[model samples]
Target: MREDFGASALLKIQELERKGAKLGMAQKILLAETGTVEQVLSILTGSPIRVNVTSQSEEKGVISREVVLTSDAGEPLIRARSKVYCRNLPPAVVEKIRRKRLGIGTAIFSAGLETFRKITKMGVNDGIPYRTYRIFYRGKVAFEIREEILLKGGPGGI
Candidate 1:
């Protein structure tokens, strides 16, 4: 859990707009999209991304992980923290995540799980734009993720 998840420092896009916010194109995409961050980053960077799980743990029926997505050349592009409810996930999905072998999106897709993403919040903290979303499986939220875009211009100004 992040200390600033509830901080007033990060404001929603609508609120920012009312306050005259000027966001770059890439920032808008990152803040508004309801898709997988891995795919979005790949498209923006035009490179395959490697998922690096820095830490993972399970407690009280919840699995959590801190992850980074990097370009093939090893430049970090995004930082993400996700927590999945174990009860909502299939065993295979849980195992894949526990093994730290794939991004949360990939693991779910590889397991052939049908899911939908809902953007719960979007904000910028310390000049880094981020979005918090929930992935639903069988109409229940299986994953809660907050991803921070690390690139300044989102690679090649995309």
Candidate 2:
């Protein structure tokens, strides 16, 4: 936990999930301050979830994806750019992740695994955006997440 930099709700979610707890960021935001996880998606949306997979690639023992989660109306909500060490995850979980069926937190949590997230950077990119977080599993760097939350057309955008 990086005191001044980290403490974002995303981090909290990451902390909980890494401790074998399930994540419901969409719901948690409603209950507390998100610290520094950026304030773009600070407001949760009820819109239909949509995933725009920017890219999916695998090299060596790692598999990564750059995904944008948006509303059905095309309002970008959250960006989850991540890389996972395939060899470190269960095959079933990997299959689900590849099929775009489970989220990084959910995938790991469901597999009875926890994550360690370290926020390397934070700032606004497109809509209150920036770069943040490196997710770990059992002390091994399993995934790195770069996120951007789009505000326009989202929950509070309207």
Top model number, TM-score: 1
Q: Candidate 1 has what TM-score?
A: 0.83
Model 1 is weakest, by summed lDDT over 10 consecutive residues, at: 2-11
Error of 1 at 34 (Å): 1.7
User: Which candidate comes out best when scored by lDDT?
Assistant: 1
Candidate 2 segments exceeding 4 Å error: 1-43, 126-128, 153-158
Q: Compose the digit string of candidate 1's lDDT tens values, residues 1-158.
A: 56443243234665765655555666676777666677887887799999999999999989988999998898887899999898998988898888998998889878888899878877677777778889999999899999887766533556
Please list the Cα RMSD from the true structure of every candidate, rounded to 1 decimal place.
6.6, 9.1
Candidate 1 residue 109 C-alpha distance from true site, Å: 1.3
lDDT (Cα, 0-100) at 13 in candidate 1: 64
Give the per-residue lDDT digits (tens) of candidate 2, residues 5-110.
Answer: 3246456556544655433444344223323232323235555566677789888877879887766688766777788888876688788788876566656666
Instruction: At residue 44, give the lDDT of candidate 1.
Output: 79
What lDDT does candidate 1 reach at residue 88? Answer: 93
| TM-score of each candidate structure, all chains considered together | 0.83, 0.63
